[model samples]
Target: MTAEPPLLALPLHAAAPTGAPAARSFTTQLPGDPRALYLSRVWVRRIVTVLCWRGDVLRAVEAVTRLVDNGVRHGIPSSVPPPEQQLTLSIATDDTGSLIIDVADLNPAFPDFEAAVSGERGCGLWQVASLGARVTRFLPHEGRGKTVRAVLAPGPVGL
Candidate 1:
């Protein structure tokens, strides 16, 4: 009989600094199975609602969906059973009036945002970048998986 693949794991950031404003974070682990994509979206929407973001829910949702989709598309090992893969989503607000969202996965392949847009099949990061927000990718370290973070702010002059 084939052995079941091991579960994918992602570590949460160490607790925030002392006396820092509470930045909320939520995490969900879904089996790498096909249904994981659908589960990820539901978790994302719940996180947004818990944060009480009053503006641009559509943009925020799109950003997260793209990130999660990228995780599923690039992070999972082809040989691993879908139930063995995992995806993690984290959201936080800082003192600078910016909301920072991070999506992490055990997959090691870094996405080529430029190439994706040029290829006409994926435009997730490009859309996030076009929002005038900053997006960055963090490589795995100390046995952790990769993370992609999107930093968004209320438009200048509070548009």
Candidate 2:
């Protein structure tokens, strides 16, 4: 059998807003790399800390970990011809005191959010959703991939 080409590398970039209550954004390519995953977690924690997340740091870390794991496990190609792929995570906070975390990957296969909940094969999204966060998926306008996003609100008042 013919071997598939190596996965194309995706560029990673990060930025923080330049105003009050700024937000941080991160982009990374997912190529089944362990280092990338670890780095992702580190950066996520850093962002959470910078944002002064006053409650459940562990839970936030867990959520981010699951998101990266899911991207590596299901977003990559493992069959006949593995295709080049990448994943990105972006975090930001709005003036209204809401934290938005977006995890995106290059998976053409539309993930069944519901099936993922019902079946044991997928539960990362479920955990993310269970946290009272909003999840959404969309196709990139200029690429052959899709992105899944999750938005979370900060803890209750007087946390």
Question: lDDT per model, in order?
Answer: 0.62, 0.58
Top TM-score prediction, candidate number: 1
lDDT of 2 by residue, 97-146 (tens): 56666566667685566666444456788777676656666666665555
How much is 148 displaced in model 2, in angstroms?
1.1
lDDT of 2: 0.58
Backbone clashes under 3 angstroms, per model: 3, 2
- lDDT by residue (tens digit), candidate 1, 115-137: 65444546777776766557777
Error of 2 at 125 (Å): 1.4
Error of 1 at 29 (Å): 1.9
**Which 10 successive residues of model 2 have the least lDDT summed?**
9-18
- The Cα RMSD of model 2 versus the native structure comes to 7.7
